[model samples]
Target: MTRTQAPRSSPSRTSPSHLLPTEEPLALLRPDGTPVEGSPLVMPADDVLVELYRRMVVGRRFDTQATALTRQGRLAVYPSSRGQEACEIAPVLALRPDDWLFPTYRDSVALVSRGIDPAQTLTLLQGGWHLGYDPYEHRVGPQCTPLATNTLHAVGFAHAARLKGEDTAALVLLGDGATSEGDTHEALNFAGVWQAPVVFLVQNNGYAISVPLDKQTAAPTLAHKGIGYGVPSVLVDGNDAAAVYAVVRDALRTGGPTLIEALTYRIEAHTNADDATRYRTSDEVAAWLARDPVDRLSAYLTARGLLDERTKDDVAREAETFAAAVRAALNVDVEPDPADLFEHVYATMPAHLRAQAEFLREESA
Candidate 1:
């Protein structure tokens, strides 16, 4: 997640409320497109806000295109971030070029916002022979499908950067359900002990596949769990794009590990295969639609005179162009060679496997 920046609050609105999340989710704008009143929330500069909005538009378009590919059998599986666009875009925009991002399977949109090619970002889901894009090229790790495991990798990578005397930070995106995993616990512990620069952004999108947040945990909120590991935590309305961006920017500037739980909803089915309607009601989805991230930002920007009809039209046109290109790219088949299966298996290939590769090579030849 990259482009978000906004403000926060809690019991100690004036006090140094480190480690305490605001009573309510932090937000800079209301659903009706008005800025929240009487809060010290820092609004992002107009330019940054506009950029955030644009990337989100392009990101969502890319997301829909990816989901469409699944229905066309061009992809194996796709977890749609249809309603979680704020969590998908912000925070990555706050990063410096030297920073690293450890994303989850649900974060193809985030990867695109980070300037990754859309086709390369979907290569894994397309069953490509490689990771599709070079991880070094964008400093993004392979998309981790296993829940919460990526957090540990982020901690390790950030700690190593610290050891090497580099000012690098790692932002790891996890779902609400991932907080229960032991890997999240260990990652927090290690990050706290080493004071690593790692920001854990939990997109609490209401469900972990079929399980709702209530069934997932009894903790007051996911952010509170950070206190146990001595990591500072904050809660924000994930739908408020500006607020999300502000909180993430401050957390990174705070100079240590932070955990953020952004309250959002997963509008689509868990994937191209899961049936979301079975677990959630249409009314529930409708309510969230009123608070949609993209709409919230667009409305707020328009009211402030920062966004005009022309700008909106231009953004939409650009998004459509991007989507068309992605569609065209995926329309072509990318065939993988059989011998590639053994290529990255080991640095020093064993004799038996070496014979197998040779046999396959001979067969192909």
Candidate 2:
């Protein structure tokens, strides 16, 4: 079945009656790039909109460049967030400097938007050491590879900050597939129980690594999963940057956990290693391309006379420059130091590891 068709909810699971009244995905922009009637979106200033557009452009270029790099063997692998550029740029742009972002492996675009250097952000995928950049410096957590693990960490950090009386909120990004993990359930439950200041953005990009949403859950919607934990939930058009930013901003102000399920589609295969044509039809992808987030936003801006030919040229140049930098950085080869593997594992190495470290050191010498 196509994504537009509603999935059957399992009879075994049910949501509470007090759930928030948001069954349909909230969308600010129409397919034609006009605002929906009575949309809650108070359009931001022209400058803000322009910046959002720039980031989305840069993000798409980044994804494209990374995917190419992976194919060229410059990087290990890349999970391209090609169609979800709006989801990547908007939420991070809505955040305050002090706020923290916890992202999944697919969220390298989000991390880059959070002011992380592109090279450092892609380091993990490059098979480099550690979480490339300092999380404290950017107020961003490491790009978590394990599904749903970072959700728990985000909640714990938010709860700890609340206990310490710090005005901080954590925004955790997850995929629709992650909702199936036990870690997601536990984290949402605790976040609600503690009233932790956190927002969970579940990008429902159709398939979950070949497993479609129908097989992932039978809940009314992924957002409804939050209501079971006593947390409010909302559905948003993941492709609409304005709607996403507004929804996430409101969630942060609500002073507790909120779940937002963004209905979007992944335009690319799961990763460089996976073949999407095997599981999905090209027709489905073509349909989503018509509603591409970057194009929609660009159309809106152009219609408003905010983005002219010169501005478009400038943004394109900027994106190209950014992509060139990424290519140049990834082209440089750095031989991994054999002894460095022993570093950062512990404050003090265990005896056996110490012996192993020494043996490797002697062998390398």
Candidate 3:
């Protein structure tokens, strides 16, 4: 049998296979829109696939719209997750509404897939509010700009939920560069020690803001890093939406901490401010573009008779409307409130901060 062929029967299977990720990234669908024979993983239902495709289409449109917003000065800066739609949308669909999501600045598309308002998702990058949405309301923490810090937060929440006898899980999204952070080590250690119901989704999009993975770490794959902490890790083809959903669903079902490294590529620059052409070649980008998650799934579904040209057009129209709505929502003229920064810092304003607030108010006046 293949290394990943065994079904996950128990969470406490004391076997090496359970402790280590597959040697190769797991994939359910190939680029040519066909399933891999003997993959052991169950394919999602046609209805689920259709929903996933819709969300992916909309999420990607929202991503590109945010990019355009940056160009139009509607946002201060924007990070694009163009080629990583499967990694973004699938994981969100894998979570229960009660489960928490700890995301980074690059996971705005995931937030959109989670039913978050597009305007609210960009609040931090808008250079306005601390966070446009309340964490408790959405069961999602504020998006961390720093690397791997949010992983620790996920562990803490998961571990505490376990102690309280709550059947809860936390899913945290990290970039390939975040694997090098000290908190990544700490988070994995704590999760393994406590057996916290947390899943780490590391989107390994090749480069970490110009530093290639080769330059970052010597590990075979970022998923392998979990083995050191006694956490089970798996690598998945990030462009295969079906594979992402199946793998993540299996991990969550085991009811413990797991790490997943998704093999994808960042098609756009690090952010709107950076130039991607300097660090990467067009040929590489074109190769990944041809393997786009959205297109691959659309093709597979259409071939299977689960989707039609009409449905595809309808989904695209919906995505366009969603993008247009976000555009309208953000196309507003508003002045920043100088006092707002000081308001959330303290329950009762500290004397020093009070003075600072007053000074800023007077200066503005």
Candidate 4:
């Protein structure tokens, strides 16, 4: 009694708790707008921070504007990246000039951050032209719409770069739902075996169309899937640009294939044609809104006295000017040629395709 009977250890210490597995990659700013210790951010450096903020704002504005255009029947179906701007922007910024990017359908915001002309994106969306740029010139591959197929392309690119002794890396974007596909698994396996310099970025936006995450897999986390493939994996806050950038940079420096599972939410419908309310609840939407990336960054900047009312107004005005310019450019009515498809099939058209092209020409005439 006098020795205060040795504190009994809880037997629960040996028991594992069934909690969702997560990897909290380093975050520069805390939720309350405070800087974390040893963060890579230099907030006082106004130029870089302001430029990064501008890119994020412009990307978001462009996405919102495009959604409106789709609804107004100006463009065909458009993927809305409403709550995903920061996730797209961060990795694009972290890339070197010669590095390659494999963008998915919803990664237009990524192209914007990587210096792609907004008009070109619009042209593709409006069906006025093919991608409208030489992929080699931009080092950005054509957008892949066949879900997880681009993962293999990224792996191949990395393997080629390694063979050529090139100091470059490949970054491939995919949706969380894409992980269920065989291609995604194969890509990871090959990359890991070869130690390819590539990064597999999975934007976990909680839903693949109408199917929720729980139904897709019994695995604790998408990032953990990489473990079996022998690729190092990490999870990060996709909504936070700083966090995303940090993780991408780390992956790039590590010199091997890495899988990043970015935990984010799809605030808008999957695309303009989708009706999220049919499956998800309003309460879920409201909760995500509370964690809005732009709002979070704005609050942080304001709290630090870096952003004020006048600065916000200036940002708004700049965004509006950009949107107006994009709108005017997109309004130009230019229909692409149907025959152009046959033109690019080969350097010298195959005999059968050539005959087919002539047949089409004669039929049209």
Candidate 5:
């Protein structure tokens, strides 16, 4: 049977009635690590949950390390996805090998979870040239800095793939703030009209920089925005890795446009340069800290006897090793040749650029 049709074990645990999504966000696990009522249609195995937990640990480490690197004058800047690791890693795990992921600037964790080397994934953030790694090699689009621009690119790619009759889908991720951009609306509209095999996952981290959701839009919910475009929508607890994975996997099986709005929080500032404390309160941060995605999964696994002290130690050791490797890779300074900047702009260098390149060459000589 296809993965979407795979049978799942029956719900073995009962949870509070309020835990499940009605018109609310779907939450599969409570904050205390208990399973919610109405279990997912296609539950993943214990091993899969273990792996997801491992990735979440690594993703958290990556964010912390990157933020430290920025503070230490190593990286140019960083947009840390500290509190949203579940949203960062789960959807990538749900996709097929041939599927494409279009990530936002803050989605370094997602790209890393998708098999890109941590160093390569952060290259753009390091102020390096040319998106760090080849997009075609990894089937990941550029780590886009411009808001909502990559949404259109993802839709176009999916439409082209459908035209070519390829069994492929594209997943586009954007911040809640980007939902307000015109490009986002246009992309969703096109995807719905064409029935493109693309999914849009909005990580609603409660703010657009310092602007809270209340200030960003008057829409009842971001998912509602998709309904107007003729696309189905889901509201998932962004902190529940299992639920996010299940929803994304099911959406992929539909072979059409869908939108998933994950209600999450951005634990860190918008980036290393921004001071979140100036706008948000410490109590607010403390409240979300209680609902941390990594801690939630670890608690659930431990309660189920799936995670023990040894396993926790192993995951922590692995995360430390990964962080060390990323630090070492990023510490090596790269001295780019100034003249090489003029080489890749076009197949044949234009006369104006040729003159500029000559000027740089003579100056350096």
Candidate 6:
């Protein structure tokens, strides 16, 4: 999860007892679009911010397109990232080119930001011959659908990198719900013990499928759990990309494991197959909408004169073009050969598997 810096609360007008209570979370921009003191936060260069914005726009568009494509039967079910693009993009862009990313099944946005082709995402969803490239070769591990299992793999990768004297780090993205899994706890322990160079990013979207966070844990903040394991942790406003970037950057740069619990809300259903309306309220959605990440960033940029109507229009058009291209690419059906599944299972198939493969072929005929 990324660090979002909210406006600083000051001690009263000039008196010792006039101080206001500090908001638990930090945010450089408030919900109303006011620019709080932007300094002291790890301020990214303008180019980096623009690049981050581009990635967010592209990711949002890709998610929208994929959702539509699934409805049209062009692919298997898609888990929409609707309203959570910044939650995906900021930390991803904060990484060095050589850094690795371990993403969850729903984190296509992070993969896209990492330079994975849009077609590859569709291919994975479609279950085509190529669910895409070898992730290790791409420096982004395979998408982990088994909840928190990938966090262990990330720790292992970071451990290996340390052994090899590699300077690169790993960032593992998992949902807030994943924190409840035993694998997540074990991974945190290993990462702490080994002092692994990885960042456990928990995108706290307030729900674990239909289960709300309250039912998932009694901890006041997920970040606090890291303390028990001896790993430093911080909770941030997940929607503020700038804050997210700064916090994540500091964590990654300092070495060892850091847990960033990004506070956010998932506005849509867990996936195309789930109905959020069944378990949540429209009022809750409306309330989160008021703190939408994109709107907040846009408002900040506009106030600073960095984003104008023309620039906004251009960004929207560019995103639409990318979405159209993804739609067009998914239309091409690439069938996987039936024998291909067995081809890559082992370096050399044991006699039993060899015989089984033949048996399968004959049985199919």
Best by TM-score: 1
Once fitted onto the true fold, the runs of candidate 5 whose alpha carbons sit more than 4 angstroms away are 1-21
Please write out the lDDT profile of model 1 over residues 188-219, one tens digit for every residue: 99998888999999999988899998998998
Better of 1 and 2 by TM-score: 1
lDDT of 6 by residue, 64-156 (tens): 888889899987878887778777999888888778999998888888878788888556777665558568666888888799999999999
CA displacement after TM-score superposition, residue 49 of candidate 1 (Å): 0.6
TM-score of 6: 0.89
Summing lDDT over every window of 10 consecutive residues in candidate 4, give the lowest-scoring window. Answer: 12-21
Off by over 4 Å in 1: 1-17
Model 4 scores a TM of 0.87
Error of 5 at 10 (Å): 43
Clashing residue pairs in all predictions, respectively, total: 16, 0, 0, 0, 0, 10
Candidate 5: give the clashing pairs.
none
Count clashing pairs, candidate 3. Answer: 0
The digit string of per-residue lDDT tens for model 5 on 143-229 reads 889999999999999999999999999999999999989999999999988999999999999999999998989978888787677
State the RMSD for candidate 3. 6.6
The lDDT of each candidate is 0.90, 0.90, 0.90, 0.81, 0.89, 0.82
lDDT for residue 257 in candidate 2, whole number 0-100: 90
Residue 238, model 6: lDDT of 85
lDDT score, candidate 5: 0.89
